[model samples]
Target: MASRLTQARNRVVDRMVNAPRDTDERALRRAVAGKTVLVTGASFGLGEATARTLARHGAIVLAVARTAERLDELVAAIEAEGGKAYAYPADLSDFDSIGPLADKMIAEHGGIDIVINNAGKSMRRSLDLQYDRFHDFTRMVNVNYLGPVRLLLAVLPHMRERGSGQIVNVSTIGVRIPPGPRWGVYQSTKGAFDIWLRSIAPEIKVDGIDVSTIYMTLIYTRMSAPTPSMRKLPGMSAKEASGLVTRAIIGREREITPWWVTPAQATDAVARGAVTWGMGILHRNSSDTASARGEAVR
Candidate 1:
């Protein structure tokens, strides 16, 4: 009954906050008409879903990813649906590769009104594995942290010059709710970027750029496939997450979605070691059930 009331209240709040008539997806999309957007990791998962959705909403979309093949498929999919999309293949980790990609987009479209930093990696190897396989941590940091920061640097100048832009970092809730033991490296790097963005928000806000850090929870995507427990829990779908992200970009909202994550973050912060210890127990228990054989902590 308590959960039911929470849902009812959440629905009412959603309607009030989003403006009931605009809560109709199409009307919400119309808010972004003629806007230009660039999404990283657009080859798959939430990134691809966001690109297609934004394109369908009359926003010009430039999709960037490392896999040329997957990106081509995304472009074709959006075009087939009568939406505008362009795919640019570039290894985001390679700083040299970003320039040309950004150049091409600016050349064709002038300047981007929104940028979604959605590229990331998830790792869950046993803590014992780090003794020799340190590359797992290094590679994850390079791909997930530095790569997005570099992309932001590349496009920021244009945004400053234009005096209007929105940047959304599709970060993970693990940074705050880190289950510990295995999440050190992944969350450490993710947390760094999350803080980095916050540090710059005040200065950038004056330049007409809205920077939002999104701490998302478990989602139904390829990234979540290895951790089998997500299937049983209430998880956000790629399309659903994408829709929330899109609304954030369009509405110029700060810290979008997983609205519940804020209280969870405060709990973790106030409890400190106690929170980590509790989460560690939750991790072990969730990973133990037979049904979660592959879904739990690996």
Candidate 2:
């Protein structure tokens, strides 16, 4: 009875937070057929699902991530399904490697038609716990902000020369709404990339390159599994989240956010002080996780 109630409540929350999307599989297949689509963080979760779906629709999938074994497994699974895929293992946080990875992909694949910036790091440590752990800020910035930017710089020229392509940023809804406590590092880094991409969209659009940003809500994945609160909250499945990515690919829209974001943003704009104060109270009342305190998870 308790489990059923939880699921029923979650369904209600999911509907409220996740806007419905219509995706015609035929249209998605037609859009990506014979194109080279590169998906970062492709070894797991949303990235893995997106890469596999794109491949199924006839896209040549370039799956990128830090774990070589996982990437290999993902590629194998895709190919087993009779879809084309290749694995490229490299850490996004290692900024120096991004250029070479992009260059190799261009050389081997002959220029990618689509780029999905889905790789990211999520952190939720309080300011008190973060004071001594400055590397948290740097790691998040490197993975969430600078890494994607460097890869885009490397690939943008080829995209421009071709005069057609699409770039999708799988961003978080936290950037679109009022940021709560314990999400400073993650939200700020994501917001930085979000702003940067939007700022450059107009200039890039002149070259016929479409840039779409998906301000995605939470999804149940290994990345979110560690958070106790997240496990209790309603979220999309990996497959559902990947549908949004394919929607962006097919639609090429400027942004895909929840139905409630506009009003939430307005509320934040008007009552920022109150929001901040409330967040502060929440912070004061809550304690950091064991992992945030440099302790191992059992």
Please list the C-alpha lDDT of all candidates, in the order they appear.
Answer: 0.75, 0.90
Q: Candidate 1 regions off by >4 Å?
A: 1-23, 257-259, 283-298
Residue-level lDDT of model 1, residues 142-230, one tens digit each, is 87888888888888888999898888888887776534666677788888888888888988899999987677766689887766766
Q: Lowest summed lDDT over 10 consecutive residues: which window, candidate 1? A: 289-298
State residue 295's C-alpha deviation in candidate 1, in Å: 15
Clashes of each: 3, 0
lDDT comparing candidate 2 with the true structure: 0.90
lDDT of 2 by residue, 221-248 (tens): 9878767778777789999899899989
Top TM-score hit:
2
Every model's TM-score:
0.84, 0.94
